[model samples]
Target: MVTTSTSVRSKSCLGPPSDMSPCGNWKVSIVTSDLPNAGTSSQIYIILYGQHRSSAPIYLYGTDRAPFQDGHEDIFTITVGDIGTLFKIRIGHTNSGLSPSWCCKEIQLWNMNSGKQFYIPVQRWMARDQEDGEICREFPILNKGQPILPVTVYEVHVATGELWNSGTVANVYISIYGEKGDTGSRQLFRSKNSFNFLRGQTDTFFLEAVHLGDLYKIIVGHDGLGPGNGWFLDDIVIRDPTTNREYAFFCHRWLDQEEDDGKIVRELYARDNSIIFARQKLEHNRKETWAAESWKFMKGNTLQFYNRLTGGFVRLHPDGTIDATGEKMDKYGFFDVIVSKGNICIFQSHEIRHLSLALDNGCVTGMASGRASTELRVVYQPNRCALLESVLVPGHTVIFDRHGKIASESAAGYADLSKEFVVFVKGMFLNNAVILLATSLCQALCLQPDGSCTGVGNQSEKSYWRVHKISSGICMFESVKNARMYLRIKDGQCDGTGTGDIDCHFKIKKNLENASVSLESTKSPGLFVGLQADGQAKPVIYTKNGNVFFYPRVIKCWHRVALLHNKMGMPSVSGALKRNR
Candidate 1:
């Protein structure tokens, strides 16, 4: 049982006298529990008691970033006198704020100088209305040997269906439940995508919590506010980055007070079909690498968009108009999907030399190239045509009327093949392999020990690289020889290496209808990792032929083993220049 205390200790006698030596800094991590009214807005303080000396009350406060949130971990550092062998700690809060009750899960402390760690478990409520009504609590040192739960940042993808007023401006909140536990309801405030909760839009968000194991269900709702509070939720996909596992929940319903069930909240369960579809989607993407083809090649390529509703193909005209009237794949129905950048695609009409399909003020029309409205979100799926969603107009997708003419581009609807676009071409795959410049296939890109990146002629172990996914469509290439070094784009150059972090991640975009890939730095969006004719690596602005083509060389496991063995004094092929084929 936890020792409850109500006595207030005077601050004058809490610390060592002014003439003593400091005991060094301590890193403290406090974990809040997932209990009702567990987060406190009041000022919190803690006093450490040791066998030799005690510490003054240290206020647990930091910058404007709020801490002590429910089901969250807060870290702080404090310096005190020689407090040898910590035995107990007195922790409390000034009873303030609307809800002053707090539930502490545990407190972990690490002596920075000595490298000693101490854990104190306090799974109790220190509130006035409950648990003996004590505002202060004392926890003694207990070697419970319990491991703390690892925190994970979960990727959440929320899709709004194409329907009348399917989007809401109300504050949305979601809670995920799994076999282990549940993530407390967190507000879906900031979205990686622009403007959250819009009709026909899919917003991506990140929620950090203790690992909840395999997710089973989720509760999603909104605080019914704003002009249009009714929202039509299409579906949700949550991915655990650590295991690369995804949980899919299909909620083809309305979360509105005036809708079908007149409810503003809903609980959706994970479905097997959704999970399979997600996996298949990933697999299909992995199999196909994208690159921008030459204008000559792209102009000759014929792409088709099958309109399911009209049972026809999207046809283009010389007057820069688009219609879904082609009964079969013909010259008028042929187009080319040009991959611009990170999921942004352009559909260039083969019938019209400079005309491209675009979202024109909520209407699907033909437009000239270089227009911002021409950029669309064309999602590639397995065994199916690609889905075309508007990037300029958020959730709107391309659709055609029964008469075959282009309908509204702002349709809030579920994915349908009739509303899908497709283009088949030879692509590249560079997930995890040895990278070689297309011009110099013998030289392999490597991250050196001296924090420099360049292309080496020998395909040694240092030339191998592993791709680590940072976020959706973003990844970092880490050196297989030394995990700490990564191929990084910095200061407009890819000639330097860095410790794989957010700064090192690159937005990988595939060129449509080609066999090469572009690595655009997440830090500097337009800067790409480029190669020179002499096999040198650097950052460059992407162009048609600035030495950006890279070919992936598949190295067998046995080959790596043989190289290691040869290096370990076996009959070695020293000075032998092994060229990558």
Candidate 2:
């Protein structure tokens, strides 16, 4: 927790910290976008902010090898003091190099003092000619928010048949489709295969796209223009970098103008369950190998079990209850692997009670005194679980149905939005305001002396909003400090009303990739609360207005509050571990 003091300094806390001032060491990791020529040679500077104080703009420098290069992650550490509860930061570069623009993918900051990490997704370009033409950007910390859909870099390996005239130079194009979406047709312009596609050769190319979840099939073809465009593709294997899962599409048939089906394009489906069974067999073998060496480093050492299916940490409670809902490494989230007399391994929580985790009748729970389940597998390095690389605050699974109704993971014994969440609003004129409500007459909901709403620079009791989730994804913003006020849209106009009626209800559709959110009026389907030219909230036609998007960045303290609630609800266990069983 960041300490708040009456006196704060607005300066950089460089060098070592003294005993007089409170200091925090932050490890900042940044990833540049993979777009062509997205790197920047200009000097970058960042200013950190806490609840109150702000840090001086510190120049960011990297080794002479290369910094801010395309598709690369760079790490740096800085020491600062007096800034409490880091909330926001301003990052930009001095436009002075040959290619000064930069497309940043995201940033991760770790506080050594709190052992807490924050992720800031910035899939935007900071350039003079790019979208909105804004160089500097401010992003608040994301805590207990929607999971950002990762941009997965897929490794596409195309294998040519080991037969005559099996290679094609007619500009082969490929497209992959999965459950969530599809990557548009892309040409195999560049390949790791030296001479591109050739007979009996395996050419590898990289394709970057939004994660498509479970791949189903792929379309591969050639232009069929060259003299010998006939090609016999043996198979195509694609590896998703995010999950390390590979999908194989077999195609033993020839894709030629006058061969087989005489087609230039062919669709191939993913292999059936045999491959999955084989992979599972391999995974079991690997786990057994690890169990063989478990005696060396498994006994009496604190560790956490990561669920392979759901990206969550396994947590055991003091009262012999367990769940797989933890998102960080904490006291309750740690456990000891107890190897008994018969070489059987038991999972014991790192608590005074020493509860054992076990599975019984398809349910996973912690028992005070019973036979622990040895069915638990140890994946030393689970796919995408890079240990604190992208750890987020623990949050309940939230899903939006096709009808825009929100659904919580309640079947798994998880609660929905039960607590008041704090968010800083961005987009339009109310750029960094804490209050999301604004009157059609006023820019923001500022209570004046006359008891009327007006626009003001200073925030008051009326500025704070409490997200009151009435239904799954449907919520009404109520004033936190002043309970009488609720953000309402009446007759297609935005305003604050004392009455919390149906007009206040809004259907929230949050983007899985970033903090951008859209609010639609439940009463008026196509009517949305969009921003006017001056940044005031207004009800605009959802189809006509593009400014209906807004970013609500969750504050870090909310994570602490959520963590506390999670700790208090330790008596109940989660059914998420059933997949492992």
TM-score of 2: 0.26
Write down the lDDT of every candidate, Cα atoms only. 0.66, 0.59
Model 2 agreement with the true structure over 413-500: per-residue lDDT tens digits: 3332111111112111221123343221112344333333333212335455666667667877665656667766786567666377
With a 3 Å backbone cut-off (N, CA, C), the pairs that clash in candidate 2 are: 406-473, 429-535
* Model 1 lDDT tens row, 1-581: 21221222334343554432454567788888878668888788887766666677777774545567688787776776676777667677887888888988988888777888888878877776775555666655655664344557889999986443567899899989876556656678678767898766899987765566789999999999997777879789999987788888878678989767899999998863665866754664433422211221242234566655566677778877778767554777767765455567787877676888888877778889769888887665432345677898887777765667666633434332246543433212234433332322234566666666665434567677666666667877777777667878876667546777666888877543233467788888888887653345788888876356454443432334355668687643332434322
State candidate 1's TM-score: 0.32
What does each candidate score in C-alpha RMSD? Answer: 23.2, 29.1
**Alpha-carbon TM-score of each model against the true structure:** 0.32, 0.26
- Which number leads on lDDT? 1
